[model samples]
Target: MMGPAAMLLLLLLLFPVASAAGSRTLVFILAGQSNMGGRGGATNGTWDGVVPPQCAPSPRILRLSPALRWEEAREPLHAGIDLHNVLGVGPGMPFAHAVLHSHVLPPDTVVGLVPCAQGATPIANWSRGTELYERMLTRTRAALAECGGQGKLAALLWYQGEADTIRREDAELYTGRMETFVRDVRRDLAMPDLLVIQVGLATGQGKFIKLVREAQKGVKLPNVKYVDAKGLPIANDYTHLTTPAQVQLGKMLAKSYLATL
Candidate 1:
C-alpha cells in the first residue's frame, strides 16, 4: 500500500489533467480548524442562518465535493470533510467572490475551492504524516484531477489555532510546527513558492491566545503571508466568526492574495 503522498504523486502522474491544469481554473484550499469549517450562526452546531449575498453560489465557483469531484461552490465549504457538524458561512465564498470580481486574474478564469477544514481540530491533527494531513493531501489531489487539465492551485487560506491555544506548549511551538507544515505542503504538491495566507487567531482560550496569535503574525517565510483577524465579529458562541465577519475576512484574504499576485 502506498502512503498518501505517494498515492497523490501517482494520481498526478497517471492523470495528466492534474498537471495540465494551467491557469484557466484558479484553485485554492480552505484549511484549518472550526473557524475555517464555519460554526457561526444565531445558534450553535446548526447550519440555520442567513446566507450573505456576497457568498451567493456562482456557477463559475466550483467546490471539491465529497465524491472527490468538482461541483458548484456553496457555503460551509468544509461540508465534504466528515469531522465538521454544522455547515454555515465560511470565508471561502467571499474570498472567491473578491477574487472573481477583482482584477487579479483573467475574466474567463473559474475558481475551484478545495475544502478540507475540520472544526475544533488542533495543529497536531494537521501535522505532517497525521491522518488529517494525509486526508487533506488526498482530497487536494482529487481536486486537481477534477480540473481536467485546465486548473491550478493559486493559494491556501488557513484560519486556525484556537484549539492549540488551550495548551501553553502548543502555543509556544506553533511557529515552528506551522512553518514546517507550510514547507511540507508546498514541497509535497511540487509548488515550492505556493502562496500561503495564514489568518491570525482572533480569539481563543484565555492566556495562551496571545502566544498563538503572535506566532501566526510573526512567521517569516517566503511566499507565506499573515492576515489579521483582530476585531472580527464573532458568532453567538464568541468562537467562530459571524457571517458578516466571515465575508469581511474572506475579502481580507482575497486582498492579501491579490497583493501577492
Candidate 2:
C-alpha cells in the first residue's frame, strides 16, 4: 500500500542494514609528515594499474576532509596525470594490497586510509593544543561515520619527527606527548587493540634520532610498535625518501602490520 517514493526509501534503509549485518570493515589511519604523505618520484612498474581487489573499485580511495595542506591523489600515481596513463605508485596503495595478499584482512574488508600529514610540520603541531590534531580528529571521525560509525579504526601508522629533530629540548616531551596522543585516540575510538606502527625517521637527523628511538621504546602502550629505518636511503636533500625508498618503506610497513595479525 506504500507509494513508490516511500517504497524506495524503505528499500534504501533496509539495504544498508542487510549489508551491515553480513559485512566486515577495517579502517586504517596514515598519520605523519611528508614521508607518510608520500613525496617521491614516479616510476614504471607492474603496480601501475594495480588496485587492491578488496577495496571498492573506481575511485578505490577517498580523501576525508584533508587536514594536510598538500595536494591529494586518490590513486597511487602522482598528481596531474590522466587515468589512462597512470604509471606511478604511492606507498598506501601497495601497503594496503600487501595486507590483502598476506591474508591478514577480514572477509569483505574495505581498508580506509585517513591521511593526515603535512610537509615540515613538527610533532608539537599534532598535539592537542593545536588545531592540526583537532582537524585530523574531525576528519577521522567523519570518515568512520560514513563507513558505519564507531569501532572502525583498525590501526594507525605514524611516520614523523624530521621537523621535531630541530628542537632538542622538546625531544623527551615529544615522546610523552605521543604517548598521551595515542592513549587519547584509543580512548576516543574505543578500540584498545588499535595497532599503532610508528616509523623512525630515516633522514639521519643527528641526536634527535636517538631521542625519538628512545621515546618510542619508552612508550608503555601495549598496542604501539616501532618500525626501524636506521639505514634507509634518504634523498640528497637529507630528508625525504626517494622513490625506491618509499617502496621499500611501504613493504616494511606492510610486513610489520601483517605479522601482528
Candidate 3:
C-alpha cells in the first residue's frame, strides 16, 4: 500500500520543476473571494488571457494546482481553483514575484503559492464545517507536505468582503465571522502566530461596502495585518481590480509580507 505522501503525490497531475538541489519552499495561501481569485481580463463570459509583465512566471515560484500538484507558477493562479469565475489574473503571481525580487528570505528559498480562493464565496461559507473550509485546509496541508518536509507556511493572504456587503445582516456579522475564520484557520494549522495579510475592500456587492470594509479593518487578530484596496483602479464593471491594479495589489501584499519578516 502506498504511504500517505505517496498516495497524495499520485493524485497530483503536475510535478514541480524545482532547482537542481530543490531549495526549501516558503508557502503562502491566497484565499477569500473574487479579488483574491483574480479577474484581470474577465468580461462578459470569457477571459482574454492577457498576463502582465509584473505577474510573469519565475524559476523560484510554483503554485499548487487544484489537483494538488505543484506546477510552474503562472498568471491566473486560481484558474483551476476558483471554479465559477472566468479568471484572468490575480494577485498571487505578482505577490510571489515581488517577494522573490525583494530577497526577503535566503536567495535560494522557493515560494509555493496555494490558491484556494473560490470567487463569489461568502465569509459564512468558510465556517469550520463547510466543504469550502475543509477543502482549503486539506489543500493547504497537502501543500506543506508536498515538499518533503521542507515547506513552511509563511502566511495567508485574504481578500473577501464584497459578497457579505450585499446583505445588511451579512455585513453586520462580517467582522466576527472573519475573526472566527482567522482564529479557526490558525488553530487548525497549528500556527497560532501565522501571519495573515488581508485586503480591505475597494468595491462591493451592495449598500454595505463601507460596513464590510470596516469589518475587514476591525479584525484585531494578532500577527494579522491589513492592506487597503480602496483606491485601486477597477475593471469595466467597477467591481474587480484591473490588471495594473492587481499588479499594485501584489506589490502591496509583498510590502506587507516583507514587513512581517
lDDT of 3 by residue, 96-198 (tens): 8898899657888888999999888899999998988999999999888777678889999999988998999999999899999999999999999999999
Best by lDDT: 3
**Against the correct fold, how does model 1 do in TM-score?**
0.88
- The model with the greater lDDT, 1 or 2, is 1
Using all chains and alpha carbons, the TM-scores for the candidates as numbered come to: 0.88, 0.73, 0.92
Cα lDDT of model 1 by residue, 130-248, tens digit: 98898888988888877767778889889889988888999999999899999999988999999999998888854699999988877899989989988999876767788889889
Question: For model 2, which pairs clash?
Answer: none
lDDT of every model, 2 decimals: 0.83, 0.62, 0.87
Q: What is the lDDT of residue 178 in candidate 2?
A: 84
Cα lDDT of candidate 3 equals: 0.87
TM-score of 2: 0.73
Error of 3 at 239 (Å): 0.9
For model 1, the local distance difference test gives: 0.83
Model 3: lowest-lDDT 10 consecutive positions: 13-22
